[model samples]
Target: MKNEPLAYRMRPKTIDEVISQAHLVGPKAIIRRMVDTKRLSSMIFYGPPGIGKTSIAQAIAGSTQYKFRQLNAVTNTKKDMQLVVEEAKMSGQVILLLDEIHRLDKAKQDFLLPHLESGKIVLIGATTSNPYHAINPAIRSRTQIFELYPLEEDDIITALKRALADSENGLAEYNPEVSDEAIHHFAMASYGDVRSALNALELAVLSAEQNDDKRQVTLEDAKVCIQKNTFQHDKDGDQHYDVMSAFQKSIRGSDVDAALHYLARLIEAGDLPTIARRLLVISYEDIGLASPGAAARTLSAIEASERLGFPEARIPLSQAVIELCLSPKSNSAITAIDQALSDIRNGKAGLVPKHLKDGHYQGAKELGNAIGYKYPHNYENSYVEQQYLPDTLKNKQYYEPKLTSKSEQKFAEIYNNLKSNKK
Candidate 1:
């Protein structure tokens, strides 16, 4: 315990001491409710690293008198789980914190399922990977899933100050002088990872030159300790999808600043392909009919981005994102197609009208195909009102133009005119 890192040593002994994640451990929260009622169940905690997944598990265990054990799913063998099981048998119940639970192999999972069912092990599984996608279904089905959020800057600062004041498990014994600038640097540079911030604070304090009896830590010391910023982006993780969703949503919601912000994050990740595809989809799906030309321009921008690649590609993408954010939005086209698809899927489709059927065959007239088909080209304005849909669906209407922009308003007028003529 004396040689353990500051982060491990400063682990909260109770739920109340855990920093941030009030949503989970708050008094009225579900986990706290479970603790209060002593109705513990197997659950999985998932999010980015250094976000109190293990700490929350420990706190929950500490809140109860049950035996607590910790193990890594990857590093620990099945035999390690057996040891916990043996202890559970003796103690009646054990709270087991399994780290990297997404990597739990089938063998270990098979061994744990029966115990999980028997209520002998109240498993608290923690993983940076999303449990739904990464964990085996057998284990996932038997556990409640909760997502942990990153610690805010204030939360990190609060934890850091607490660590400095904690003498027993923290750095209060050093009596080092830490500047506010240094603390701010640690809070910002670590990017919501309190563990990284605390360890860096420890490094700065331990390695700094002593000013008589006190070592004064500075922003320069904080910078050297945390050499690289942890921005917390995983290409295959939830953050990637989250950013992509926000990017399109911002554009649809017509917030240029927000759209650009998410675009910048995607650009920073160098995800040109995903950006290009999402932009193309947004052009038609969100801005359809209202600004048809914008969709064409977005296509050109995507082509330019693909040809130019990243860095330079960001220029075109940024321009396109700005234009899209400002573009008038409509989803009429997508809505119309989806409605038609739904009807077809639900067996609403009927036989094609005989007059609209192909009449090029030699025996077409005998079968009544195209017998009464009046060519619209021969009529005034290349328009004629006649039944095009099958007799059963002759009254079906799908495309209802959302008169959002001038272009869509014009389309709506024409559509209404044709519908009137049909009646």
Candidate 2:
């Protein structure tokens, strides 16, 4: 037991024993009902790391009389899935727990699709990615998706207390006294990750024992332990949000140096590849034609990042960030879309004009749907004046394209033509 991993030995064996995730494990939860009635469905648990997804699955297996088979999708293949299915055929009731199911390729995922629909095996998938986007739609549609939130700070504190008090696997031998300040520090650094919190606690206690002077774990001890241990960077947590905010604001403010710094921070912090791609989208939608090349360069950076992971990828992300920051900024396009959405949401959405609704020019000219609309392509300059907006917003100037060398010329010509037509 001394050589065993702390994560393994501390695994909860019962639902009551499991920590956090009350929304799913509470008395009246759908999962609890299924376990009580022995009628569990194929379900997917979606959440960040160390949030008790595996614990919940194991508890469900223990509660029901089902035969449990576990596999990691990162390493398992179709062959392993086939083997599990074969065993399930002869079992009483089968619960197939697939960890990191999003890591499974489309082909392997498809293997379980038919089996899930036919109710041959109760499939339980655990994933860190958004199931709606990560899992194949066919597979996602077949399973009941349940989102598991990250562990709360209070829950992490509770878990730390339990670990300290429990004699079987806790710090009973060392008799280390843990301070409240130390606990608070651990909880904050854990970032809603239970496993990380527990690991930090175990390490801090172990370090205190080695020192021989004081057997008490202090706030300093916990901080030292955390700094020494591998810092697990969660891309969806606070750091992710903070860095992205900084990056976006830097670009908006046209601070190239600041933007590059934030970009480097995210790269070093292990942000997801897709997040970098999303920033590229903001560059185009917010900056638009002000700097035509900004969006294209950002896209190229995304592709490069995807192809070359990590250290190699950081270069492209830095390049994109700098380029976007230096580009002339404009948000008229974003403002236009946002205003339109707000109007729709506020119930002020007006109808499409009658003339635009039906082709009056092709048939009944007096029907009013398409009576006065002009075709822009049919004109000499391939531009025409038309009332594209609702009557109330007919003259509203939403998109004021920035006056820049790249876009000013084209917009000037178009604006003059449209203004003359309106007169």
Candidate 3:
């Protein structure tokens, strides 16, 4: 018992002790109501690992006084099922805890179905995968599915504090005193996997030498136990947008160091897709015609990132980030589009001129479409005076070229020439 992990020792013995999932185990909750009346049926507890699914199952068995037996689909066989069923028949009913229930073979499922229907066995199937998508429909249909969410930082912190105080089952034997930073680190860095946090806490307490009165667990001690210091990043939250904003602005400002810094931060957060997406936007929005080839080069990098993924994906992402940061910047394309959008939105737009309208359809000539249209290809330098917009919008200008770099200047020269030729 002393050799057992702190997480195993700290398993909530009663539903009330289960801190993370109040909706499932609180007063008048589904599990509570069923357990109080001993009217529990087959259930599937689904969520990510180390989030108290197993603990809740054990808590139910204890409270209901049902014969509890645990098995894994990975190692257990059909014969094992037959034995448990026979014992349940002799001694009333059994509560069977099936781990990785998604992997339950057809033979075992077939044997368990009738037993479940007859109330001889209460099957508690535990799976990390979503039961709806991963579990067989027959199994899902028979079980009440309760989803377990990842434990919040406060809940994990409270659990850790409890473990430190409890002499009977926790780390109290070591007379450990953990720093607040250490405790907080465990709470957040564990990423809602309470078992891993508790295990790390246990190691920190056991390994640290006593400092005068108690084993002082420092932040470094905690980090050593957990292996990595997690930089809190909410990919779907404000921080994600903040970092992205910084990443793009740094590149636009031509601050390569800052851009690379933000890129590194995002990579450590494990959001290559976000970084890739932001980089692609920068290629066009910031680099634009100033470096006309930057967009294509950045796209190639993104494609490589999509294929490689992660640590390797970072290579292409870094290359693109560097290129975009160094390239001359422009927003002419985006500004041009925004101006056109503003015109359309505020009713500045007009219909295509009669001469400019498509006239290839049947009887189009009768309506006078393209009657006076000037064929530009037939004229010198492919130049011809033409009315492309409606009579009300003649000579309206939306794109004014900003030629800063050689590449942009080339486009500006062509635009100027066309404007000069237009009479």
Candidate 4:
């Protein structure tokens, strides 16, 4: 029993036996429709970890008359894929299920593309990443993509109850009774991962029996089991959102230490490299010129992460967070641009003045486009008097620099000089 994995022992054998995923099992659902009509398409299931993608694939095969073959993208090679294709050809109607399909490299993905397109095999690929981005477009185009959302709290509760009461593979022998409060606690902690909830329930039941309290599994028992097991991160769901929210808020609030802590959380949780890179873009877009170097430093960290990968790349991320938090905060430049755009959108479609229309000033003695545009680089103290703004907005000010540090002081001076010269 110790040698056997819990997932293997409790694997759902039939569509009726499976828990959660009612959206796919509901009346008139695609899977149900296919099962009824005896017609299944080459498709992909995209979802978070432990969300029943593989279980549903197996159930589909079990429910249908087609011969089923399983392949793991992590271990199966191009040769294995070809052999499967050949077998599928002989079998007439065969369903080939590929687990962790995103792990397959470009060459392996390309090798399967032709077979997928030709419908030599009914393919069911499962991934924890977004198939649109992770899968080869050619292969993905041939397969219908179905998104499996994380289990809701109520769905998780139902799954937990089913696992506890099922005689074949659950804790039926112990007849353990779990409280509603305890179930709620476990569901919340599971972060919408049914597998995690089941595992935790199984461990708690075992622990209760070990402690001579086999009649019931309480919140205390559940807590003990959770504490004993390593806190696993749910990368594609709730935990991911929770940690990222903390990270972004920490940066916005200028708490460098807290920001770094969240960064570490994401890295330790095995977040995708592209996702980490995207956070850098947020650093620039939201925390921009306020910290002039924040965007640049974040971009540099992104590049380093791409080159060096995790564990080692976290150092640059930490550095960027600290620098951003310490740097002066300002969004005036962004605000100015956004406000101008808003004005344009609000029907402020002011046309170009006759004097500045087209290239009318290209050869004019009044300096044309260059006229009224101050040459600050060629004036007293590198400053010049000019009327550069459109006449309608001649006195309007947009960017109001903050006096956070010496850099901002210089920016303020330049802004003032430009405004003074315009008068």
The CA lDDT of each predicted structure is 0.90, 0.77, 0.88, 0.74
Summed backbone clashes in each candidate are: 0, 3, 0, 1
By lDDT, the candidates rank as 1, 3, 2, 4
Q: List ranges where model 1 is wrong by over 4 Å.
A: 1-3, 28-30, 33-39, 132-142, 172-175, 207-210, 227-229
Instruction: Provide the clash count, candidate 4.
Output: 1
Candidate 2 overall Cα lDDT vs. reference?
0.77
Give the poorly placed runs of model 3, Cα more than 4 Å off.
Answer: 229-423
The TM-score, computed over Cα atoms with residue i paired to residue i, of candidate 1 is: 0.89
lDDT of 3 at 256: 91
Pairs of colliding residues, candidate 1 = none
Over 1-423, each residue of candidate 4 has an lDDT whose tens digit, in order, gives: 344545556667667666777778667888888888887789999877777888888888888867788899989888988888888778777789999887788888888877777777889999877777778877777888998877888988887887778777777777788878788878877767778888888877766643354567788877765542344567665457667788877877788889888877777776747456656756655565556666777787778876887778777777777876666666666777887888778876464544444444446644454345445788778765654456676676778776766666788898897677656
Candidate 4 positional error at 257, Å: 19
The best candidate by lDDT is: 1
Query: Arrange candidates by TM-score, highest first: which order?
Result: 1, 3, 4, 2
Q: Which portions of model 2 miss their true places by more than 4 Å?
A: 210-214, 228-330, 333-422
Give the total clashing residue pairs for model 3: 0
**Candidate 2 residue lDDT tens string, 1-423:** 256545556767677777877778888888888887887889999877887888789888887867788999879889999988888777746889999887788887778878887787899999877787778877778889999987878988988888787778766666768899999988888767788788888888877754455479889988986652334456755446656777788788888888777776676676746556667777777687777677877888888888998889877877777777777776766776788788778886666776677673565565656767788789878876677777866766655656664574577578766777887
Q: Kindly list the per-residue Cα lDDT of model 1 for residues 88-133, writing each as its tens digit.
A: 9987889999999999999999999999999999999999887878
